[model samples]
Target: MTLIDLTPAPAATARANALPVAIIGAGPIGLAAAARLTERDIPFVVLEKGESAGAAIREWGHTRLFSPWEHLVDDAAVRLLGASGWQAPAAGRAPSGRELVDEYVAPLSAHPAIAPHLRTGVEVLAVTREGMDRTRTAGRSRAPFALRLRLADGTIVDETASAVIDASGTWGQANPLGSGGLAPLGWDAVADRVAPALPDVLGADRERFAGRHTTVVGAGHSAANTLIALASLARDEPGTRVTWLIRNAAAARISTGGDELEGRGALGARLERLVADGRVEVLDRFEILRAEPAGDGVRLHGRRAGEAAAHDTDLVVAATGFRPDLGMLRELRLELDDIVEAPRRLAPLIDPNVHSCGTVSPHGYRELAHPEQGFFIVGMKSYGRAPTFLLKTGYEQVRSVVAWLAGDAASAGRVELTLPATGVCSTSAGGCC
Candidate 1:
């Protein structure tokens, strides 16, 4: 998380002072940016693709987050929520995704300072300079950004802004079932049988999974969460069976924290107990190559130990993790790392091959800056293909970026972050998968 040198050119500075800053997405990080901007008295607008703030989190509302309330809530949001007499959740409690949205994100969005600036059901189709594309560079830094957005009423509108902060998260872009990151053959044909990464097994989605032979793919916290839920479901419905698949030869990648482990530690402990009880069959070294419709379910084709292997199951939860959507930023000038697609200077700190322990140093506006000034991609989207991003890190990112935007150079340059060390080293650079 080294803060690279970022001296906004004179032309870019002039443009930044001209109009309101536009923020993309209204998730936690996006709202955090709005909070910071509100505190600074900066004019800003939040464009959310979903109908309301934290809509994405609502999709996986049943799954509990490993991080506690303290780590999840941003400082600026707390300040605003406190003024409105909002009661904070217990710091030690690890809340479910839904609780995070309902308690913190939703309240923060509705705060008087943020509500007027927020616009939900507005999707940013593209972001570029007002009068220029990627090819044009003359006086590029002086031009305001033109954001083409699709409104809730199915009408397209173009808005102009002095700066753009893309906090749009990676939840929408799920990894495919095929090996090598490409979609498997006939992936679309079996779309109906492919279960999402995070599903509420004991809740609303119970009917789709109970008493069914399910296969949980990927070896990450998400997969672990699903496996734990499915195990609970299996206890009541003895006919239900779960198969855990991974590319690694062993389950060592699972983060089983020490006795001192607290919040997320419970998840690790639960997973360890589930493995010990042999509740879920482990299929190690299974590289999924393809998926096809097999009767009412799916047949996954892959290889294990140089031998072709196939698994037919009623449901396939490909919790292979997610990737940032780069499609919307095509017209913007960005210097991304060849491997991770993260900001060039920031990739080394997050690349799985380099930092396996998930300890990213503190970084800020400088590290997130792009060739196109006044533009920053924070949150999980900043990590690109890497999955090492934490909510705390995203909060820190907005704090610095907003500080810089407000012309507080001192605060922007002095970025600080403290994160718990995961002693476990991941086989993949990001998280478990």
Candidate 2:
């Protein structure tokens, strides 16, 4: 697995420092990191598998964000875009994912300072140290990082960098619908019957789910948001039914709000009321074990109260949240939490059992570092399987990381941001952060 030969520390640092920093993904976080590097005059390259920036978010553009534009926009990006006459959107108005790309991501990516360094349709297949595999230890810390890239034209190439910042998000790697953290029986054949999280049920996907029964499997914000949209669709389209599935004995996770639109999160409260009013059906303690195609629909087989239970539905929405695709980092040295899969030091703070998207305290490079030198995983990928990442938090992360890379320890250690103390979004339409 080794490529370039290893060298001594002083010589390796001198040679590696001359190489550009490599950033994976061109999403908001990746581009923000690029902006920070650009502001510091540090040479960097951004590689995105998508042909355009924010490609993943574009898939769910119909969903509206709860956070205002002020929180979505990165300070370093703002400074760079502002100089190019790019005016910020009104601070208080929340934007849909499409609007976010149009009003922010596109402009930032097109900025004179960043456009040249942005490489679209470039996918990074793997990341490891030059002349080193996961087993090699001596002088591994001093070797430059090697990246295997798949280009737009299907050509493979090798690239190296002084530092690697993985802002590649987890939006593409949604978790399975099975109960035991793996795909259910017959998943391979009936996979098409399953839908991703936050499907545009009211708009783009109205035809597919209009009069069909959908079994939504999950207890997170994405599940609640999809339920709201399906409920709304049912109002206009007859025969539209939603079956809420959960492994827990009770649906306590979605009943956060106290029967009223409180000061904090309210999405859960709306969902609770809907369930109470019989607008949606609940199937708690149902652990899905198998799924098979039954006619044009799908048959979900699971256990309820230790007994066999099965349900036939036209579609299944697996809003089970996402997990970081760490397959590419097989040769890297990483210390991640056993449960959440987040960086070890950051796991406790962002773990779902203890922290919420808005409550996770502001942290920086130190919390994101790996045993492999100059490698940091930022953005939603930093949270691993936990669905508790905010865009602003990603911005602050890169700010600290870039500062540390630039030899500014003081700025890297300082916490300059504060987050809202609430949990999930206040509106049902607001999906994951």
Candidate 3:
């Protein structure tokens, strides 16, 4: 890594210096930023749109993560949690989303140093420089950021911050089912037939998939996890038909066999065997074009290998991956890659079309920054449309960004991270859809 020492910035305007740094989202990465700022004795605020912290992860809490406990817990958060007599889960135990939040996120949010700065049930409508839009440039770096927010009670208010780190993940912005990356025709009318990316099959959502013809779409781990669950459901419930679809010629690259991510490798291996046993139907090179009503179910119109095709199913688990919500940041000037929508410098490292390594190179604030000074996109959202994010990557992101904000340039610029035994696989370059 090149040594780019970001020495302590002399100082900023009085207004900018007095304001606290604003960190968006209260998930693992956002909260980790808070802890890092606290360690630096810097004031900060965390805004969350959900009712509580880690709201996005809680939505898919039933699904187990491919990485284990050690990789999930952020170092700064551990420092805070450890002081309160918190016990760490076994290093090798891969936990479900629920366990991740309950064991690590919940306790970190409740920590006194961090809790006072966190505000849940609030939404950030837009972000821009005070008294200026993206077009204005004079003195932009000196001006504090103006955040337009809607309160839980629907009241609108404006907040200001010296710097902003958007750790708000991409889970809420699910990719559409269309082959062209847009929602298929008649999508809104037939939205009720689609299940979430990670439906609680064999649990809360079992009744929806049991004894029904359910089709799982996409070619990522999200699809694999749902397929495995639905396959299990078929065993106990007769007449439960399962079908898997992918845009590629073959169904593969769910996960790679490696020494590091055992849980993920196991998932890919099991899914392959399940498909071989003829328990789940495989549809490759299938492109969805539209949707229409089919009695009580829905018929998806598409093309299979340039020929028209159709499939009717009672339920559909899109599992089509996610994308960052760029609409709210329109007022802020951003330098994004045209294709992936990530920071231009970071896009090349994570672009699945260009990068095929087992893992990405270590990166920090320098790679995460945009043209808008003092603003950054961190965590999974930083990867833009790429689906190669891991919890440890986000941890490193906030750590460096917060250090730079605290005027510790050396720590911010000195990026050192490695995801052992892993590399990029057949991930979708088009937002993992």
Highest lDDT against the true fold, candidate = 2
**Ranking by TM-score, best first?**
3, 2, 1
Model 1: how far residue 207 lies from native, Å: 0.5
**Span of ten consecutive residues with least summed lDDT in model 1:** 424-433
Model 3, residue pairs in steric clash = 6-409, 357-423, 357-424, 358-422, 358-423, 359-423
> Please, what is the whole-model Cα lDDT of each candidate in the order they appear?
0.81, 0.83, 0.82
State each model's C-alpha RMSD to the native: 3.2, 3.8, 3.3
Q: Which ten-residue region of model 2 has the weakest summed lDDT?
A: 1-10
lDDT (Cα, tens digit) per residue for candidate 2, span 1-433: 1122211122347788898999999989999999999988899999999999988878878777767778788999999998878899997777888999899999999998889999999999999999899899888766899999999999999999988999998886978878888999999878898898889999888999999999898887678888989999999999999999888977554547442214224767778888999999998889889989999999989899899999899999988778999999999988888888888888988877765566778899888877776888998899898766777888899999998888788888889887655433322222243
Count of steric clashes across candidates, in order:
1, 0, 6
Sort every candidate by lDDT, greatest first. Answer: 2, 3, 1
- Candidate 3 lDDT: 0.82
Per-residue CA lDDT of model 1 for 75-188, tens digit only, reads 899999999999999986778778988998899999999999899999999999987999997888788999999999999989899899999988868887677889887789
- Model 3 spans > 4 angstroms off: 1-11, 256-260, 354-358, 421-433
> In lDDT terms, how accurate is model 2?
0.83
lDDT of 3 by residue, 1-433 (tens): 3223234442458988899989999998899999999999988999999999988888888877756678778898899889989888899677788888898899999999999999999999999989999888688778899999999999999999988999898877888999999999998877899887888898998888889999999888788888989999999999999999898987555655642355667878888898899998898899999998888898999999999999898888888888899998999878788888888889998887654334567688888877787888998888888876666777888888888887788888887566666532211221221
